[model samples]
Target: MLSKNLLSEIKEKSDLLNSLKPLSPENQAKLDKKFRLEFNFNSNHLEGNTLTYGETELLLIFDQTEGTHDYREYQEMQAHDVALRMIQEEAAETERPLLENFIRDLNAKILVKPFWKDAITADGQDTRKQIIPGEYKKTPNSVRLSNGEIFSYSAPGDVQKEMAELVAWFNENNGTEDPVLLAALLHYRFVRIHPFDDGNGRTARLLMNYVFAKNNLPLVIIKSAAKKDYLAALNRADTGDLSTFVEYIGNQLLWSLDLSIKAAKGEDIDEDDDLDKELELLKQELNQVPNEFEQEKTYSDVANVMENSIIPLFLELNSKIDKIKDLFVKAECNIQISHVKPNGYHDQLFFTSDDFLFGSSFKAYEIQAAIINFNCTALKKTIRHKDINYTLQIDFDGYNYRISNKFKNEELIILPYKTFLSKHNIDSIVKVVVSYVIDEIKSATNLNI
Candidate 1:
């Protein structure tokens, strides 16, 4: 099983990856080329688009030995090569091929081979002798394996449904969860299913790497030297234990993250920055802000500010939005205070679109009055007395004015105003809201209302 300490280390590695900025276009192209090279190295066996146990093993050995082996090695390698090539050729091309299609293709190819189908003979008698076909041994259709026995291969019928479910799950959740964990789960599940007649291990690893590439992560290699530990993890997964598999995959993810981060930084990965702690603190601070705003701030208000105001502000401060830390510091503003009492209070405040009220606890009418005041100042218009009840209205010229008292709060709805304003970019409304709030707070507190 993977220790908790190792899991913590993996989390740190993931945090480091998340902290990285996007690479430059030139660097991105370079990284893509490197990734493709590694991918091709691992996937080159399927050049014929068919696979069988023999062909798969041949490719595995070829990848390991670079085809520089002696006669004995070549004989052993032939089984793997033949198996993989047959499988690839039989697999039907589809717009979106599935894992089962790959396995079924391999199975059909291997089953038709006379060498695989014919019973072995000993002592000139056709006494059936067991032979290891491709890479794995066959068991009775309903039998299970004991310790030290060959890896049991299941027929295509036994695993088709399970494989389909796995692929469906991967497609749906690929982008929703952490990619590293998602890949790990997929890898473990695929290996546990063990759906192919042979070469299931290699195919499972290939699927794992496919998921990694789909998620824009680096490719992971399961070395032959580590095959024992890999099988142990799969065994644990078979027994419904996943801690070991999670750890094994988490370690691979850490390695990928470390390499990618190093390449991006143009140096060895650093450990000094406590990014997780910093992020935690920032989240806590954001959570402390209350939801209520005196000026009726809707969900759209915050979204607008973040997307248009905050994002652009950061973009202007730095060429890219990667320098979020600096942007936060620069965007900080003091909260202006405002107070309002019932007596002697104007029904509405006049303000322009440029005013922003920061903090004020007053009735809606007082808030409206402050907005009117600020709007009149910016528009250079005279303040006209009107009997508008709790509604504050602003014109297109950045002037804030109130309707007559006959205007009812219920009828002074925002739908028409919203529809009219939508023609202009919503950011313009955000600026108006910010300015209105700032002025309202100042006016209410100054006049003790």
Candidate 2:
């Protein structure tokens, strides 16, 4: 029988559990597998056992009846092992910098391990190596997963810097705001960075759960079965869109919370609440508050909106231009705008003017204009006033194609018929670029228009 203290502790945990809804049997099974794996990994390490990839994965198999054939994948084994070790090390650390150092160290090791020999040529020549700040020259490779898709193994330099900044920011704001949302944002941002040439997905998932563990929440696993949805969530995040990923992960977390709550109560789990409704309600509440006070908006407010919001928009826009440039051969177009020289100027039109707009507003307008210009230039040809279809030659297919249009903007340059058809087929790519621009614009200005 459980002791009085154990029962009391269980009751205390139950009270916390009451705050969550129940989860489905499928979700419950997933949560159970993840918890078991995490538990076994931690327990083994605590008992002074060095864990391997195979062992880590076997721990995830709650029942052996399904057959162990699928667990034969070596990469999966390696990924699980590294992920568990990182989680264990993070859980063991009490200090922030130390925790970060451990994570970074793990990231470096995972990146170089599988691709080490391949990272160098047979002649002993170094291949494409990455320069991590403290880790020095490390080999980063693009490894193809079992799904035939390739992913990089090293954290990009910019992503590493952003992660460092985010870690610092978290240390400063950890207790002041809601930890769940903070953790979500951290997870979203980390995955968006896609750091590491190889284990980025697994590492990101671990880091996300690490944030949850820091907040005393159960670990959330994005199972291989949910890999498609997971990738979709991440792709949405890549374009600075968080709604899908947030909804997806939040649901997973709520499911875990429910199961843990049920286990605490020593009762058979029934049903979990739909977190989407609760999340929507929370978002609505957040939207009602002034941007200056909202936690997500705090960085924007403190950083003068321009540096925090506008510059990122510009960078996002630049990335879009690069994408559009890639679709067309011999269609080299450089998009740039003159920086607005600050002179004490104020008026509605002046505020709207390219010359007078400053800070975030300037950044927003410039990017918005650049995107519109690029799209229009890619589509339209000659501008016509009144009823005339003005004729003009626009570059397409390594040849200038004669085209006409009824619009007045010279900024519009229409590609030829064949070129337009070919480009339209890649509409998803275009949507990604446009969505990236839109997300950045919204982030920078919060301009509903």
| Stretches of model 2 off by over 4 angstroms after superposition | 1-15, 18-34, 38-82, 85-89, 92-99, 108-112, 116-160, 268-449
Instruction: Report the lDDT tens digits of candidate 2 across residue range 193-284.
Output: 54544344445566677777766667765644354677677667656777667667666666566568766545654333223323322432
C-alpha-based local distance difference test score of model 1: 0.41
The deviation in Å at residue 341 for candidate 2 is 91
Candidate 2: residue 214 lDDT (0-100): 67
lDDT tens digits, residue span 1-449, model 1: 45667767766766676677586666665554444333333333222111222223334433432112223333333443454443333322323434555544444333333233222111111123233333233332211233313333344455656677877887677568765667778777766665543445555555566556555556675543354677677778767888778778878666667767776766533233224323322332333344343244433443333333332322232222122223121222211113243685544332222233342222232232211211111211113221111222322111212111122221111221122222122232233233333334223222100
* Prediction-by-prediction clash tally: 54, 14
Question: What RMSD does each model have against the real structure?
Answer: 28.6, 22.0
Model 2, total clashes? 14
Q: Please provide TM-scores, in order, for all candidate models, with all chains considered together.
A: 0.38, 0.40
